[model samples]
Target: DQQVKQNSPSLSVQEGRISILNCDYTNSMFDYFLWYKKYPAEGPTFLISISSIKDKNEDGRFTVFLNKSAKHLSLHIVPSQPGDSAVYFCAAALNTGFQKLVFGTGTRLLVSP
Candidate 1:
């Protein structure tokens, strides 16, 4: 079973517009959530994270929201730039020290100029 799922495989948006990516999870043990942005040839970089205890978290133009009851989450990018075009992965951890994260397949975000 897919512990995490990104229903949309890709999203395209114009530059300076908002890009929204959605994710859903079936595991209730997950307590820490993270979003990673990845480029073509490099590893994913930690973009933002939200703990299950909190409803939302933000950094710069990136924001993440967690809904524990619904087992869903989303990442929002405001005024997305061309540089923001890449693959985004939604991941979750159980809050244990090991933090074995489960990742979604990934969503490709294309920001056109």
Candidate 2:
């Protein structure tokens, strides 16, 4: 079974603080990892991604780290802002022709002023 798990359903943090979201996976065949951010009533937008061959990837305020041995991954948001309050989903997929992605239920992040 392909299951991506996000253990924390929600998180709250002060503005300019760091926010960390965690994810775990059961399928060992997943080779591509992705993170998507969603606002209310909007589709998820790709935030960052990493291939299984890499341990870490970063883009400005966001960074993702993968531990292949443990089948775990995490997203880190630095100096989070009030606008950053939204749901985040961690997804994984195999680089096959199907191109279907398995997504976690999602974690809601609240950044206070």
Candidate 3:
């Protein structure tokens, strides 16, 4: 079963605008949520993350928010640039000693000039 899902396959936003990406999960055991950005051929790189204990986390232009009650999370990029265009993946993990993450299909973000 797909525990994590990104409902929107893709999103388009103009440069300098705010880009919002959403994710939903079916598992309640998840305690950590992470967002990863993958360039064309490179591996996914960690962006921003939010723990279930907190509602939001921000790193520069990136911010991640988790709504535990709704089993949902979202990534917001302020003043998104063309260079920020990439595939974003949402991952969730349980608080168990062994860290195992369940990832979403990914959403391709296209930032246009």
Candidate 4:
């Protein structure tokens, strides 16, 4: 079974600091990894992603790092603000054939002012 795990259920960070969310997967065959942020009643919105062939991908305030050998990945948010507080999910899937996304339990981030 392909399992993605986020051991931490929640995290608290002071505003204007950096927040790092971690995720580990059991499937080495997974080719794609993604992160999403969700608010109270709204659906999850895509954050960032990294391909298996690449180790890191950065976009604006978000950066995703993939360690293929460890089957681990992490998302880093710099200068976290109160508005950045939300539930974040980590997902992994194959990019070929019938692609199916397997999601982690989710980590809720609290950016405190």
**Candidates' C-alpha lDDT:** 0.95, 0.95, 0.95, 0.93
Off by over 4 Å in 1: none
lDDT of candidate 1? 0.95
For 73-99, candidate 1 gives per-residue lDDT tens digits of: 999999899999999999999867897
Residue 45 of model 3: what lDDT?
96
lDDT of 2 at 97: 65
Q: What is the C-alpha RMSD of each candidate to the true structure, in Å?
A: 0.7, 1.1, 0.6, 1.2
- Location of the lowest summed lDDT over 10 successive residues in candidate 4: 92-101
Query: Candidate 4 lDDT, tens digit per residue, 36-89?
Result: 999999999999988898999999999999988898999999989999999999
In terms of lDDT, model 2 sits at 0.95
TM-scores for the candidates: 0.97, 0.96, 0.98, 0.95
Error of 4 at 81 (Å): 0.8
Candidate 1, after superposition: displacement of residue 18 in Å? 0.6
RMSD of 3: 0.6
Which ten-residue region of model 3 has the weakest summed lDDT?
93-102
Query: Model 4 residue 34 lDDT?
Result: 93
> Can you give the lDDT of residue 34 in candidate 1?
95
lDDT by residue for model 3 over 40-84, one digit each (tens)?
Answer: 989999888888999989899998988899999999999899999
lDDT of 1 at 86: 96
